[model samples]
Target: MNGILLLGGHSDIGGDLLTRLCAGRPVVLAARRAWTLTEVAERATAAGATEVHTLDFEATDLASHRALVDRAADLTGGLGTAIVAFGILGEQRRAETDEAHAVEIATVDYTAQVSMLTILADTMTRGEIIAFSSIAGWRARRANYVYGSTKAGLDAFCQGLADRLHGTPLRLITARPGFVIGSMTEGMDPAPMSVTPAEVADAVATEITDGKGSTTLWIPRRLRLLAWIMAAVPRPIWRKMPR
Candidate 1:
């Protein structure tokens, strides 16, 4: 099994996906810290990855994204499947005070994903591109609209790229999980139908195995319908509403 390459291997969703999907196959994990490599490798090995390797992957480092893709291909021997799951949750007030930090979150949430994924889409031999987007992008709330806008951009890009790869064997699975109970949004209020990283991971695994073509997976799945309603809501009505 030419295993899967997990870009944000340290994330809860990424970890769970590896545990569920990499049984009897090789798995490679990548994150911003090399220090985390060994721990991830060990967990993946224990979870049934025949081999596991890690490398440094900083979302802000766009110039190096192509190199990262090349490295994953070299390590995994043609890349069975790849999941790009990097994200950040920062305070909106702080984002106002520190424009750089807000930009960083936005870049990580959207632009970095675009950079790395474009490279992966070109380099992947025969695998799926599974990305974790967010529902916050739908109706950018005042509280976290900064992060939400970023996801909105990424969500649109993923769909367009999926269409671009239509004739090829490559599949794009864009996962949007609502109010996940996890570290990223520790102090954040839970939205309607909040879920766990495990739940998001479950949807991701199914999207890959199902061989569905270019479909976005909403954790709980029904969120797709809700997204329509959310998008339709007028800005004035949405803005006056409380977060």
Candidate 2:
């Protein structure tokens, strides 16, 4: 039996996705601290996963991504589904002065995602690649352009990749979640159309499994209209608009 590969099982969205998905199928959870995530596996098992495997995967460690993909394929006969739910959000002030911190987030958010997807996409003959991007990518937000820029790059990358993989049995699902209630966004004000882990997971499940052919999934569905309105606004006005 094949397995579903989740690069960041430790994530709230990732865990929710795994719980709702992979029923009766083995799941492979990859993370930096593999041992610390035994409960992740247990929960997946309880959620009807056939089995669960753990792996060491550091998002920023680009060199190890090849090895990670190799290991994932070895565990499962073929990569049926790949969910990249790995990311980080740090203090905006700290990231401003710390050049290394800024670059680290950017690399992890964009560079490493490309590397991992390339490796995973190559090995995945037929499956869906669901990437957890953010609506922040749509435009540069004054509050968090550092992170926004990274997500912007990712969103564009996914679009091009989706076009490239056209008619090849390889599906790419770029998920641009608005404000998600998760560990990362703790203490922050949830955006207007905030969603939950389960909701995002459900949207992805419906889009991919049901053969919707929708490469981009804007959470809450209405976000499609919202994004259009946002895009039509003048840049000068957009810059001044409060987030």
Candidate 3:
């Protein structure tokens, strides 16, 4: 049976997307804390997944990523999709002052993502690798520069990688959503054009199911124009805007 794998299965968006993608398919939910996914696995099964399995996945552990990919392929007949949904929205203030915190943010958000995506690209014979980027990457704000910078790097990498996969069976979809109001941003004020986890999942599922296979996805569509406007803003003015 073919399957869908969620690399960051514990996140709200990941959980939402998993339910949407798992219909009539086996699913592998891989996360740093796999044991806590009993409820998620149940939800996937209830949503029509043929079967569900949770695997221990450490984002920073590059050495074991390939093995994890191999196991997923082995468990199911093949992977229909692999969602790279793991990332850290590190505290900007703390990251600015602490070197360790900065490195943790960069490593998890960008480095780990690239490593897993590279492995998935090389190993998967047929599937799509969906990654979550943010509109924040379009232009780094002084308030959250550390997180934004990592997403910027990831977005650029995924774009170039998509170009390189021109004739390949595998594809990459980089989703750039505006501020997502969710558990991740519990106490923070919502930004304009904020989207819910289900909304993001629905848009992505439609893109995949309808064969859009577009290299990039702009949630709510208007984010595309907003991204351009943000990119064109002068640095002096950009730095002054409160994010």
Candidate 4:
């Protein structure tokens, strides 16, 4: 089997997913600061990875994305799986007044994801590409619309990309998880039906191992019902919903 590449080396969910998928394979972890990948690399090694490597990555550096993928492919021989796991949950309140902050969220969470996914789809002849969407995207709330809007756009992109890859050897597993309670949401109150990084990883990893074709998964599965309910919520009330 070809090796695996994780775009966000330091991401909690990405690290967990790598531990699940890295057995006997060469693994590449790419992050903004390669040094921060040490713990994740060690875990991958303990999990039976034949080799573990790290590369410097910058999600906002669009010009460098293709080069990073090429470098990863060079390290792994050819990538059989790539997890697009880099994103930011920018400060919603600050973003309301700071255009730069809002754009930063847009660039990292949506534009960068699109750039990377397109490159991976075009370059890799087969295997899987994993992308993250969220319940925040299912219906935008006033509290976090800036962040939510990006996820909304990303979810739509993934839907189209999954269809484009239909009947192909390459498959996209778009994971739509709800309220992940992790380092990202350190001080925030946990939302109803909140899940952890491990849970998200497990759901996606199981699908990667056992599923066929490109599929969009509502992590926890029941989130689909919540998503339906979310859609039917009137805008006035939906705008009042908490993040």
Candidate 5:
């Protein structure tokens, strides 16, 4: 089997997913601070990965994306799976007045994601590419519309990308999870039906192991029902919804 590459090597969900998928395979972890990947790399090694490597990655540097993928492929011989898991849930209040902050969120969450996914899809001939979406994108809320909007755009992009990959050897697994209670959501009140990183990892890993074709998964599965309810909520009330 070819090896696996995780773009956001330090991400909570990405780290967990790697442990689940890395057995007997060469693993590459790419992150901004390659040094920060030590713990995750150790875990992958303990989990039976044949080898673990780290590469410096800067998500906002769009020009470097393809080179990063090429380097990863060289390291692993061939990349069979790629997890595009880098993103930021920018502070909505500050983003309201800070143009730079808002753009940072957009670039990281949406634009950078698009850049990496496209590179992976075009370069890798087969295997899986994992992208993350969120229920916040189901409908933007006033509290976190900036972040929500990014997810909304990303979810739509993933939908189209899935279709484009249909019948091809490459498959995209877009995970639209609800509130994730992790380092990202730290200090915020956990939303109803919140899920943990391990839970999200389990869901995606299961799909990679047992599923076929491009698929979109609602983590916890029942979130699909809630996502439908989210849409039916009137705009007036929806605008009042919490992040």
Candidate 6:
């Protein structure tokens, strides 16, 4: 089995996906503090992963992305799958007023993903990429548009990348979930049809094993319908929606 590369090893969703998908395969977990993944690496190994390795990954460090991909490929033989899941949701009000904070949010949420995904596409041999997008990007609202905009950009890029990779060895599994109620959203009010990281991971794992094409997975399933409905909503009405 080719090794799996988990780029955002610190995220809850990444960890769940690692445990769920890496059975009988090698896994390379990458994050800012690779040492923090010792527990996750152990769990992955216990869950049937042939071996587990950790590497320091700084998403914002674009200059190092190619090297990171190379290192993972070296350790795993050929990375069978790469999960790009690092992101940050900055305070909406602060982002609205502060240029530096807004740039940070954009860099971390959108720019970093673009940088890493681009490198992975050029480097990976044969496999799939599970990218965790968000339903919030379906239609931006005034309340959290800052974060939503980043996701929207990411969603569009992945959609384009999938089309570009058509008929290729690589498959892009774009997973978009509604407000996730977990450590990441600990203090925020849960949105409608919110999902857990485990749920998202299960959905992703099922989609991959089912041999599905580069289709988007909307968690809770109903979000697919809701996204269409929201798309048709007029901007005036959408702007008035309370967070």
Show pairs that collide, candidate 3. none
| Candidate 4 lDDT, 42-65, residue by residue in tens | 999999999998999999999999
TM-score of 5: 0.98
* Leading candidate by lDDT: 5
Better of 3 and 6 by TM-score: 3
Tens digit per residue, CA lDDT, model 6, 141-186: 9998999999999999999988888788887879999989888888
TM-score of 3: 0.97
Worst 10 residues of 5 by lDDT: 211-220
Candidate 6 TM-score versus the reference: 0.96
Cα deviation at 190, candidate 1, in Å, is 1.7
Q: What is the C-alpha lDDT of each candidate?
A: 0.81, 0.85, 0.89, 0.91, 0.92, 0.87
lDDT of 2 by residue, 59-141 (tens): 98889998888788888766788999888876567788999999988988899999888887788888788897888888877
> Where in model 1 is the C-alpha error above 4 Å?
none
Q: Can you give the TM-score per candidate against the true fold?
A: 0.93, 0.95, 0.97, 0.98, 0.98, 0.96
lDDT of 1 by residue, 22-102 (tens): 878877788988576777678788888888878888878899988887787787777878888877876778997899989
Question: How many Å off is the CA of 67 in candidate 6?
Answer: 0.2
Ranking by lDDT: 5, 4, 3, 6, 2, 1
Off by over 4 Å in 2: none
Off by over 4 Å in 5: 212-214
Better of 1 and 6 by lDDT: 6
By how many angstroms RMSD does model 5 differ from the true structure? 1.0
